[model samples]
Target: MERKHELNNKKVLVVGLAKSGFAAAKVLVKYGANVIVNDMKELEKNQEAKELINQGVEVHCGSHPLSLLDKPIDFIVKNPGIPYTNPLIDAALEKEIPVFTEVELVSYLTDAEIIGITGSNGKTTTTTLVGLMMENNPKKPIVAGNIGTVLCEVADQTDVDDILVAELSSFQLMGVQSFKPHIGVLLNIFDAHLDYHGTREAYGKAKARLFMNQTEEDFCIFNADDQEVIALVENMKSKKVPFSTKQTLPKGACLNEGFVTFNDERIIAIDEIVLPGEHSLENILAATAAAKIAGADTNQIINVLKTFSGVEHRLQYVDTVEGVKFYNDSKATNILATQKAISAFNQPLILLAGGLDRGNDFDDLIPYLINTKALITFGETAPKLIKTAKEAGIKVIEHVDNVEKAVPVAYECSVSGDVVLLSPACASWDQYPSFEQRGDMFIEAVHKLR
Candidate 1:
């Protein structure tokens, strides 16, 4: 790892001790910074904090005491999930202390050429695709960030020749200062994470941060079909590479004569791609543009596209039980995502959906539920989803306790040639800790039916 002289002897405060916070604290110490780690979890409960304390880093746990800021803190490395409304964070901001996520630390730690991907949806899928495409390059590809592995951890091991394919979220992007990517992909934007950002404008600005540090030498691949994405990148300094599913792009990636083409060069046939859903087309175009710019040949991009099905919890096909197929789409945490998942298949769908209600009605989901034969709802949004199902003319509606309970009901409602899909159109926080856990529960429940 490159030694960051800027952090030497600096007193840096790490707020929240999750994976990112823990990684940041360790890296900070390695760069000769006096690290102070803090978390809401008790010190005994926070093994990460305990480990950091052993490394001569000062750690305060159990609570975020306002007194911790009494000392002169150079800056803060905050956990992305922690809101700005946090008492400590608000105070720090008011004091004009610089606050950032671990994402910023990555720019200081690694010399690797970064390819950052961000959007309301398709981030994981697009990042995975770009990672796979860059695998054969002389500079190895390290896929990290919000996809699972923390970017700071990957940055430590990355060399100058390496490429970091990062799946960035608005939460992570909001905290970035000078984090720039050699190739930045903005897939699409929608109304999401309003609770954290408090406004749609804030959310869009956060997503737009991917290209904020890019120069004319860098490349930015964006969705031309999304007007919001278009408007956001109008002033970007990076070379604009537009990808579209709705129209043909003369200079970027787009559909041309039934082929996925880049700059008039045919990459792959539209129908030949293995990943399901029309919504996936946007992800494909964005990844194709990014991969092509990252030195991936037509064959390399085609190879990954033809074979890769999908990322887990995002329309992943599970086992086929009694001639019925099951797809786990627990990652569909919004109406647009659920609409895409439901539209992917033509089979009679027994959709298992519902989770944390973000104060939005399910009216937008009604039109997409036309193919849905039965609706199995759960979590806090069950009533709202049930009403939507009724409006969509879904005759059979079953409100269950959770995803595990909804699976069996979905199977029971299914027949031969039918699909039992778990595509919850809300966040899983209402019942499970994360959408991954909810998807796992659905997978386990599906296996139990066998």
Candidate 2:
């Protein structure tokens, strides 16, 4: 496949100076595209912007005027974080110039076999698992997009035979037009990113696009268990290979008689895989289905599944002191994900909760919180969570300041045979740089208490 946006001395506008933005800017410059990069902040003080300027890419920080788009430019490559509602993007759209995303930009640069995975939940795990499954299989895959590295960086080092297991988010998916993967996996859909998507249906449509452009010759994997994903696949024009953990699927992968069977050819007992909760098991099942369709052998896929120690901050066991286990599930940014973390354990818990509220429905989490000893809440959404839990007849203690205050209280409350879980059913933008940072700070606080 020929590379898209060959650059080759064309003018390009790269918006937003995030990890993806910087990576995109570097590539645009390298390909001889006259790059004018912009961010909402000034470049002189911004580390990433300063680095890009040092590399000689034209920098426009603080703000990008609409008049800049009035001039002739080949195209605009947008960062996923910047919404389509932005005036700059609207102007570019009105001009009839092509607007692409970092994912689209990188997809065009490489001839590598791409595996695009998207969903409201379980996407990161699916992305990493697929990469690990292929690591020893001579593919030597690169996991990029929303997971580890940015797409531009991955594209810089990629070749055709090499696969890119990209964990694409809704933000990345929205601007995609010509981006089609060799294998596209939609794990499961739930209410997430509602603030950006504005509606559940809109978010689902973004996820569905993963397979929208896929041809009959390409592999599109669906989760039969998730009705949203299944319904979308049913209506999709693309040929789909489906997977289900709950029951047998006639076409792709299924669970039958206590064994996971893929294409009715290979079977593995659920006990053979070491992933912790039912959610992880489902993730593995989805990944196995996609991997098998991608020409990976069952035994090799099963071997990797048994060895993979789930992703960090997704039900990661932090430490245990005095019989009280500490589990860091800070990646639980929605009520559904939080409930999964809570349900995985039967023991009484002291849940350290709260973060940036994303219009979460707290009712689903009430039953689990009622089972918990008491709730220790913190951050931006703490007050709302406190009210919701109390309204539902669950005892919750609100500590609406920071993780520093919440951790020790949770530690003090936890006793023998209890688990302390930091599963904030909200975004981490309130107090940390990322979810990993939130989880790390919680771990550090636990150590101090210990």
**Whose lDDT is greatest here?**
1
What local lDDT score does residue 291 receive in model 2, on the 0 to 100 scale? 79
| lDDT of each residue in 1-450, candidate 2, tens digit only | 746457778898898877888888888788778888889887667898898878887778888788788678888888888887789988888888888788887656888888889887888888888887776666768888888688768877888778888899888888788888988888888888877888889998988888777877888788877788888777666668888877777668877777778878655787777777777777877788777767676677878877786788888887898899989898898888888888888888888889986666577787766568778898888878888778766664657477767887887777889999889998899788899899888888888876
How do the residues 1-450 of candidate 1 rate in per-residue lDDT, one tens digit apiece?
Answer: 354888899889999978899889888998899888889998767889888878888888888988878999989999999999999999999999999999999878888889999999989999999999888888798999999999998898888988999999999999989888999999988999999999999999999999999999999898898899999999999999999988977899999899999999999998899999888988998998998888877788999989999999999999999999999999999988988999999989999989998899999988887789999999999998888888899999999899999888888888999999899889999899889999999999999998
- Tell me, by TM-score, which candidate is best: 1
lDDT of each: 0.91, 0.81
| Model 2 alpha-carbon drift over 4 Å, by segment | 235-237, 396-400
Q: Residue 164 CA error for candidate 1 (Å)? A: 0.4
